[model samples]
Target: MDQCITEVKPIKGFYKLSMKQRMGFGAGDLAQNLIYQTVSMYLLIFYTNVYGISAASAGIMFLIVRIVDVIWDPVVGAFVDKNSPRMGKYRSYLLLGGIPLTGFAILCFWNGFSGSLTYAYITYIGLSMLYTLVNVPYGALNASLTRDTDEVTKLTSTRMFMANIGGLAVGYGVPLVVKYFSPDGKINSKDSAEAWFVTMLIYALVGLVLLFFCFSQTKERVIMDEKDTENVKVSDLWQEFKHNRPLRILAFFFITAFSMMAIGNSAGSYYMIYNVNAPDMLPYFMALGSIPAFIFMPLIPAIKRAIGKKQMFYVFLGIAILGMIMLYVISTNEALKGNTWLVLSAQFIKSTGVIVATGYMWALVPEVISYGEYKTGKRISGIVNALTGIFYKAGMALGGIVPGLVLAYVAFDKDNVATQSDMAEKGILWLVAVIPAILLLLAMYVISKYELDDATIDKINREIESRVNY
Candidate 1:
């Protein structure tokens, strides 16, 4: 019986990844984040204050771009699963999508167009759509790597660590580089246009290099049978969502978590510059956003094993809420206001919780993919990831809408860059602290709905492998 079980392993892949393979896989997320995180963190402020568009216009454009993604993401997902590319099924996009993605990403930050709403719409929409091409494929690639749940956790940890490194680069390094290029050494002002363009050009080139490296490192192993591939349709994404209970729960969590992160990240620059009256502190504030990942992400496997995954999530998420509350108190209190150490401490705490909770969520992606396959014999990773992508964007849509509408409600004046009214400052505070904390509460509830725990997913995976071998 032991010999029979031992001989019954899948022929192609589902082996543990090498350290090199893990780093190479992680490099992909780091590369994408360099461009994507920059957009998430800075693009709105760039549009309103530097590029000459109104906050409301920029906000609406953000929404429109995401709406296009809602359509485009499913097509990309279905197309990827339906056909095998010559370069590779999923990794091919590292070259095919990365080149054009880099181009539009840099163009999104260019001031040459100078606030022309048409040009803004064209470039941004192009960037978001092409991003789907890379993002959908890349997401599917994670599931294709291996079937070992422990390996998935390590891979996700490494990926999030690299991702935060990219975030740090955008948060801290971009500003420093832009300052060097700015004649007056200011990143937020109109005159810093040349600086912004040059900085983006450099980052985009580096991202392109990382994407090529990622392409070389990754090899797709677990995929649908060729016969299964031909049958995949765009509608399969919806079908998979309806059938896979864990996937459905994970999808809602994506919306809530991404919405929470986006709202908070988008609000950071404005908070530091306006409410805190410390533009120079912006980079440091943002850098802290990713710093906690380095400190705590490595311990996640142990943490989950010790406390169990669900309990681990509850702890970190609860920590995040506590941090947000700390931020609100520090920012609003007269005695604590303008105390740099206190502000930075609160940010560190908030980020610590947010980073760990969100980072672990990616590991669950492969589990749900396994669950889908366990129920329906087809491991349609692309379609499943696409479903997650759409919901992820839905959350981001809220992120984009809330900040603009709130700022507009408070009558935030773009012309008055030097200072905003107290009402506008209060609105920025809500974006940074209160609203996000509310979403975090929703996330906790959504997580409670998730059904796949480690042992159950492992059993599902082993059963599927046994079927393949038989």
Candidate 2:
């Protein structure tokens, strides 16, 4: 491992990365979203309808996995910060963990152990833990790339763009692929177990190839000293969270933002299938969630320059809320309920806001890391990401918990393929629209508390670099 750690002189001026480097960095995220987004969006539905688990049971499992993450995330973070593999400081895990992550991800969708909670627990938990091993390091790798705020912003934009591409693939592609492979040519049918398993296997392998591409392309430029790494500990994660105000604000914002996305994503298939009575249109509806990112993410740096970060959040989040309202209104009206175009239009509007707002928040992660380093003279990127990961997973837990519980509460009948009860449809609507909108409202408030503007973050980054150079 030591032989693989390349020693480079300390960087002084702005480290402008090549387009290839930026794209390479972004590919890691794209890979992750390819596999993880499928899990986030479709896993619950799989567990319930296809895997024969009760919604309530799946919901409880989701919560338990998050609790495990609460413990596991910090461990991975601290270990990664404290140890540098030969491949790279943080980038090494793209392979080390990525391999197992791919395997577990594939195993997760396997119905070989049909209706077995233990199989679900083992595969899901393994996948989650391995994801942390890869994700925490990948996040730290971002901060380790360069200190230039503008460069980070550009990098983030590219990353989000690629991530949305992955989302698009999963959103539209998964159902298409699954349905194509389904014995009866219906994706949502209970008999499509083999299709789900095969689809996940293909997706997971593709993800592994992408991860390897990311690993081959990325190189860590800025990193902590070996001596400093020795000081890293799991407890330092909590300590940093306690003192880092910007991190705290960002962490809380992560909770709300991810919760909004998770709830909406998890409910999307149900929304189209049950609420809108358009099972065939489910792919288009879900794909719209990623379409806006491509259209708007390229303009992020300019958008931030025009309106400022806080105002950007306010405007986009408001747009998202409006779209959610539109969705709810149209879905409930007898006249508009079955209008596919109107529904797609609403999804487009809502996703446009969501893509920009949540997409841009990632740029802030590096900013907060710089702020922490400025204040404490330590850049524990791994630990910081872990803290944020915990909160975001907390949000994801809600995504799992809320939908399953709501479905169970509404007595959603998985056995009834023809139509859901009115109560079940309403619950699905709440998951897709009302609940997520409320979470977005809270996200708006939480982001309002973030204090690290670009100028402030730049100053902090410069100061930290000067200290490193001295």
Candidate 3:
């Protein structure tokens, strides 16, 4: 069975990773997600409520930043592939880009220039750019570590496990910790500015420490040669997008998948605080997003073996859609809306589907990169990551815009603390339920086109190994 993997003999290019080695690689994602998940889950609310801006304005800033990411991600990718630092190829950025990433991440939550769109633009853009610096290279790092497909599945599982730990920390912990520091113990309010800043500061520091540990533990073995590295170009990203069919399919999947995630996550605080009218339950609701990861992630190998990857995705994605439908039905009825267990149960199911489906997608990245190498004789991991990054941000762009537009259309009032109008509540529900469900459906169709089966990918990896050891 594929799930029950044992250590294999070291092939020319393929090799097994130890537990510490797996954890060390996984730590990079965990470190990044501390800031990434926090920003995704909270920054929009922070902008509207704590930073004293309209939801529409915050949404505009998110759109602009992601647009900038489209250009910036490729540059970082090309740059990384073009040069190798003495520190390491991909691992060097864990420190180089990470320190600045932490500073900007903390700054993004600061309210010193509250309601100043200029200040918001500067800090938020800075944070997004630096995030790309770390993210693009770290993606390359995953493929650079080993060529063993089973090892990558295990590595991705560990990475997602730790990534969800950061998600849990940010999801529940950000609010709970902010509440501890918050004036009147309220998280999303104009007066909670200081609390948001302090909470981010703590998370960012911990992230930096983990990046250091990752830098120490990760080594780059599977990479392009020094000669090949010199020729990597931004245009190569476009070339790969055109020529690599698997990359194209995965790229589109990224857009749809991330859009669904962003929309739901962005709308969650409002759903709980406004729709459910349970501000106290915000942390618990958000924590459900990551709790499923712990329960399900360890079982991934077996799950993949049992049903195969595509079927696993179909099953989970459907479960998520079912969860959303349940949320819509329950929340619409006055009697059922008051049922806390029902609301949380629906959230848990929805989160389980989303977490498992999206988390495992990382394993495909290395496969595509290997495919690219087999076809072109050059492994441009950064360029492929940048292409995926673009689509991922494209999804994020939709994620950023849709919520703001929906809220604006429904006339959501940041000032109205007690409750929103009927239409506004429905808008939040659409964000949490209806819209994301539709996108999940689209993601399902997009992923259905993926042609790489496990056997095909393994044969390709072996062929590449036989030709070039690197």
Candidates 2 and 3 compared by TM-score, better number: 3
Best by TM-score: 3
Pairs in steric clash, model 2? 1-86
lDDT for each of the candidates? 0.90, 0.91, 0.92
- lDDT score, residue 71, model 1? 90
**Candidate 3's residue-wise lDDT over 98-167, tens digit each?**
9999999999999999889999999989999999989999999999988888999999999999999999
Which candidate wins on lDDT?
3
What's the distance in Å from true for residue 286, model 1?
0.2
- Candidate 2, residue 209: lDDT: 94
Q: After superposing candidate 3, which stretches have Cα over 4 Å from the reference?
A: 1-9
TM-score (C-alpha) between model 3 and the true structure:
0.97
lDDT of 1 at 431: 96
lDDT of 2 by residue, 1-470 (tens): 45677778545735888899999999999999988899988998899888899999999999999999999999999999999889988999999999999999999999999899999999999999999999999999998888888898899999999999999999999999999999887776678999999999998898899999999888787787878878899999888998999999999999999989988998898888878888889899989999999889999999999999999999999999999999999999999989999999999999999999999999999988888888888888999999999999998888879899999999999877668989999999999999999999999999988888888887777777777851
For all predictions, the C-alpha RMSD in Å is 2.9, 4.7, 3.5
Can you give the TM-score per candidate against the true fold? Answer: 0.97, 0.97, 0.97
